[model samples]
Target: MTEIPLEHVHVAPDEESGGEPAPAVFVLHGRGADEEDLLPVAAELPDELHVVSLRAPDPLQGGYTWYELDLSAGGLESSQPDADDFRRSLDLIGESVERAVDAYGLDADRLGLLGFSQGAITSLSLLLEDPDRYAWVVALHGYLAESHADLDPDGIEGKPVFVGAGAGDRVIPESRTTAAVERFETLDADVASGSFPGGHGIGPQELDAVVEFVASRTA
Candidate 1:
């Protein structure tokens, strides 16, 4: 597959990568957000993890986006993705992570994905495509994109999957976010799900859960 180039900011652990390859988490941001948007969240994660925040290939209103949503297809709550764009992004993102493993001395087996909003959607889709590639996932305020692939319970079984939702999220809808828990459960993933009392953005409680989830998996 021809991989599209991406811009990113990588934050490495304080310790050197000598005896063992460093564990890394690829951070993906929401629509209209840049790589720098989630730096704070990355900073809060375990120091042992090399945090790599990737800018979406496609530039948007002063930021970036993985794909475009066809709101006209239905509405906000039921919008459809530009299938071509989503597929291209899926391939490109996976390629980027693989390249990073070689470039930054990342442990390919210990890689994780932490994404919010559209990033969350992309993360879940990535996990479904190849569960073995990722050690764990933290998908916040996003729903599963069915167009990506068929749900494979066997492939997803026993993987650490954290599905987060904002109780008052209007952008993705609380129902949609909650639906992901069921989807992951049906796949028999070791799933941890919760809802925060907020809108489309991450709340304090959610942040704690995210940090906790990552820490547990990293150890």
Candidate 2:
């Protein structure tokens, strides 16, 4: 695999190479956080799985944003203006994953996605938009985008998905999370959901559940 600069995207191989193509997990960070934020979590996973952490394309005032936010509304305003950009970013990441699979000789059927906050939302969107691409998806403290409701159920056929949310999360409401879970179930995805007593972040319990879910699918 070609080595790319760790600017807006970072891709790395596992240290313990066994001369076999390694399964991969792509980590996406929340707004304001960079690719490095999720590197430690990569280390926590099986070293046999190559990990890649990607940064958002748009730069925020202080940190970074995947796409622009529109707060001028009755609810969250996700108009076409911002939606197009978000889709482009997802496409780029998807292409990157495909490249990694071919270059590393990794099994495309074993690809996984792990994302937190904004990244989690993107991850969910990617899987929903192009369901055949991933084996499993792990979403932490993120809600499905409004556009996701229109996705065809036939796209995701029994794909494994794990969603972890904080009951008291202010950014992503519990109600929204529940709705996302229902949406995934409606699409025939094998969904596992867990909620904890916290706000807007993950805990050890959620992490454990996510790891177990991935392990089960990859096993």
Best by lDDT: 1
State the weakest 10-residue window (summed lDDT) of model 1.
146-155
Candidate number with greatest TM-score: 1
Off by over 4 Å in 2: 1-17, 75-81, 153-155
Lowest summed lDDT over 10 consecutive residues: which window, candidate 2?
Answer: 72-81
Off by over 4 Å in 1: 1-4
lDDT value for candidate 1? 0.88
Clashes of each: 0, 0
Candidate 2 residue-pair clash tally = 0
Pull out the clashing pairs in model 1. Answer: none
